[model samples]
Target: MSRTGRFGENLAINGIDGSYGWPVIGHTFDYLSDTYAFGRTMRARYGDVYRCSAFLQNFIVFNSPDGAEFVLKDEASQFSSKLGWEAFLGRLFPHSLPTMDFSEHRHHRRIMQSVFKKQALVGYVPLIDQVVIGNLRTWPTHQAMPAYPAIKALTLDIAAKAFLGLELKQDTHFINQNFIKLNNGLAAIIPWPLPGTALHQALKARSNIFNYFSPLIPQKRRSEGQDIFSRLCQAQDENGADFSDQAILFHLSNVLAAAHDTSTTSLTITLDLLCQHPEWQQRLREQCLRIDPQDITYDNLESLEEIEWVFREALRLFPPAPQLFRRSIKECQFGNHIIPANTQVMVDCGYIHRSEHYWNEPTKFDPERFSPARNEHKAHPYNWFPFGGGSHTCIGLRFAIMTAKIALYHLLRDYSVFATEQARYRILPITKPRNGLPVILTKN
Candidate 1:
């Protein structure tokens, strides 16, 4: 298949660009095998925007910052983020912010905006600190501990407290299990809700979660608390319409997953990097200790600029969300190409972050690349968009960063963290460590 429905003066690149690589499962195996390698190979072969079929659709590849900005910051309203990810994420988080489009996206986002404001962090941080402390205390010292599951558990505890405004001791296991099911639903090959399948389990889990959260909305509305849920309960769009119970459930489910999984992934990777580079760990510890060894406030958190740089670089190397998807809602000009409406497009952040075009040494783990004197990310506006860019950027970006930094802050203060041995990784679903990211811990 070739580019179709060109509008007016612009023209898309011609030819059946890139390898289809097996029908029905076209490019899916290659992509899942190594997303970065596949993306790099495709970009090398077919300039920036090439057409290649995934399992279902032929995605217009945009492995550049310019392409990202074009799709994400669509001023002409020509793209749909909701439609782009509908196949994978829509069933799980239907009415949530990530899947909402255009004016509706804006409206929902505005209502929920208060939950992530600067003032909100003041309340959330203390709760996170307590949770981090409790979670980290469970880690066995001077021995190999699987950091992925540990971090996943820690982040969930933090998410439960910070997002839902509850400790969730009893339901944590159940919630975490359901959350994994929902995430696993993305890789379903059959791609339908059948009996005894991942998608079916996920749908069931989603229903269970909604049932769990059903009774909590009225209390949140009747009272105002510092939790994200409480703020969301009171949130209203410009039309002055409060979120109904159903809307709140959908949003809560979205927020919990968004906060939990990504934080776990990024923080685990950060720990891996820190353990691999002990000097960077020492440097971050020094910066963190400069404020208060155990106590990191919102004001002082800014002072740990070096650790912040490390976190940013970690995000660059392994962004929580490695890809951005958009569907052409109307005819739109992308560079010399005119993308027709109803076309699926993607911006591969994993490729862009590691691309030689933006950074001098893209694969190296040098945190200093993000420094003021050598600000490599500023090479292009969209070059370092881990939380994505433009209007639909992750609403929990602030919360995620703050949570990770604070957690790491306390972690560095208390533990001498290091890798027990080498660990391998794959980028399917998301970037994941093969051996569960085993690390050795010692009391500092």
Candidate 2:
């Protein structure tokens, strides 16, 4: 069938307006090719509430903060995160928190929350600092290096040590390799496990991860270790029910991926921005110098005001998870449109984060916009939701922040970084440097 015929039969029947692009493939190519441009073009042409098909499914894109708030908060209990993420991550990461819904999601999140509480987070600081400081020291000073891959490797090591309690180099190396394969599969347009496909490799990686952690779970549950893995093994809900073996495996896989991927992206972008604006780098470095590295702790991390602003601005500019997905469980009204049950909903957070209507000089790398004097993000509750909002917000919100601050503190305190002019980025999957963010670290 033609594009209009397909759209009319599927989308228009529900009273939503937008193009389905092609018949079967829809706008998959357009979306995967340039997610931001496609989103911006759609908003410009069809406004906030519009329907489009991609990855063999129909999605109603919401580009406004209010729309984001509605789906994220789910005050009416009208959406299912499980159904929403199932298509993308189900095969690769089954039973993970992001793929869970409503009550089940809450139950699992509550038990998992113990591992990220303030006391647990405080213990993680030294683990993070050790990995970061050691890695930064090994980085060749005064020589240009690809910062993205380097930081990606560093964050993976940190995740291994801090989250999984894996310190052996060979063990961390194995986890890093497989996790990369698993992450790469998330962007697969075809989610099949056919030979040599991204999904096939990811499936294999998932099995490998399961095998690696299966034997360790029993041992971890019996111990009182400090790493997240041990804590998770020992964590119990109100009913004193600990996670089953399968649950532990799933949670560990999900948390390790989340811990590293997001920090790597945020840190890469923040470093690139600082490289492009040395004035801010020097200013942030000066602030870091004042605080003795030994004085930096989870409780005092917020005291490094300049570093926090810079990282927050980087997240605002390029949120690692730019689009938050949800599926309507029942017919619901979102703004002026009626959304039918079982419809996939995407909050265009990337667009909202940089919308001219919501921010002054939205595209500029101005960290001061986040300062208390300015507090531009305070204009709207949903405006700066990089970690998401409401009940479904990232459980690791503070952990990710703490990890970023500790890494930044160690690096900036010892070295000044300079980017090779004009570093560009690609936004799909997650925002990352197109050229790996090449930069040189110069000892101060």
Candidate 3:
């Protein structure tokens, strides 16, 4: 190894090379327009490990499951999520668990873990059930109604009730708008706080969310409520350093948006698919009717395994967080290329899910792929990890699935929703219909 003027000796300067178009911006716009196409082009050209620019930073993407496990499992201690996500989400989600790394993340995760435990989830179910049925009760029938926007509102309501135990009726319009802006900021072409921009609105919204919840932290402290806010108020790290008021507000706001956005995006995908394939809708509806009327009960929830299969396929087909991001802590080898230290990296799990290498008719929306007989997901463990994998797996994974299942239970049993047209979605911030996918509702 030879020393360079200001760089490391074991350099892979030639190895990390690739042309991603344009000098500074690189393939950033290309990635924004269509992630699958850009990723396919990059993977076809540079194989598993390649170099490209996105959001004004060099992204060394490991576009395979092996690359995913290497960074996601991170047994080698060569990656930092804090630095990796810093550019994309650090503004609104600073100090959040997903943005923290190593011991800090472990400490916070330990305290926050109990919030989604069995005991806590037991209290959350009633709130979720009430919201799902109550919302759908109002949905008009025999007309084309937009599913994504309505689902978005419902998920936000669920977040307010189940996660925070708040009604937020008057603030629903304000709160929902803020989250929309915040999500839009994730893939903004110019992700800066230029006034009137999506990023600016998101920053302002983040401030508003913090301000709104700042006063409630005191109430949650004195309350014995089982909601996430109260649990966070009472939570403590290993050394018993209780999260400060600001920390609680920050973490809660961040996670509330996360739960709201990801769940809304994912459940909307399931709805779109069920609408398109009326046969699956009919099958799942019949399955739902066989279960107890109160199908959200733990036992009954488990019995809706077909709903689970549909959910799995929906997530695989259109993951909310399509790419997993990380930054190398040290020089690391991936495939034939050596990734430079401190380089931002993304593992394209979306591509992996649809990759012909691990899937049969990968593009087809076949829930049977997840059934016990087929178990196509068994082709590879990493091939189907939509909530992500390893240590940083989503904290609310079980809760999210349970919520979606409960919603579907009510929906399918009550009405048969037909797709108004073919559903097409994009993943700029959240996975959602590019034109607001509409469904025609009819009483069953």
Candidate with maximal lDDT = 2
- Which candidate has the top score in TM-score? 2
Write one digit per residue (lDDT tens) for candidate 1, span 214-325: 8888898877677888888888877789998989999988888777887878888888898888998887777766776456578777777787788899899888777778
In order, the Cα lDDT scores of the candidates are 0.81, 0.84, 0.83
RMSD of each: 3.1, 2.7, 2.7
Error at 139, model 1, angstroms: 1.9
Instruction: Give per-residue CA lDDT, model 2, range 406-443, as digits (tens).
Output: 99888888898988766777776656778888889888
lDDT of 3 by residue, 140-238 (tens): 899998888899889988988888888988999999988788778877667678999888888888888888888888889888887888899998766
Per-residue lDDT, model 2, residue 190, is 71
> lDDT of candidate 3 vs native?
0.83
Clashing pairs in 3: none
Model 3 TM-score (2 dp): 0.95
Q: What would the TM-score be for candidate 1 when compared with the true structure?
A: 0.94
Candidate 3 regions exceeding 4 Å error are 1-14
Clashes found in each candidate (C-alpha, N, C closer than 3 A):
0, 0, 0
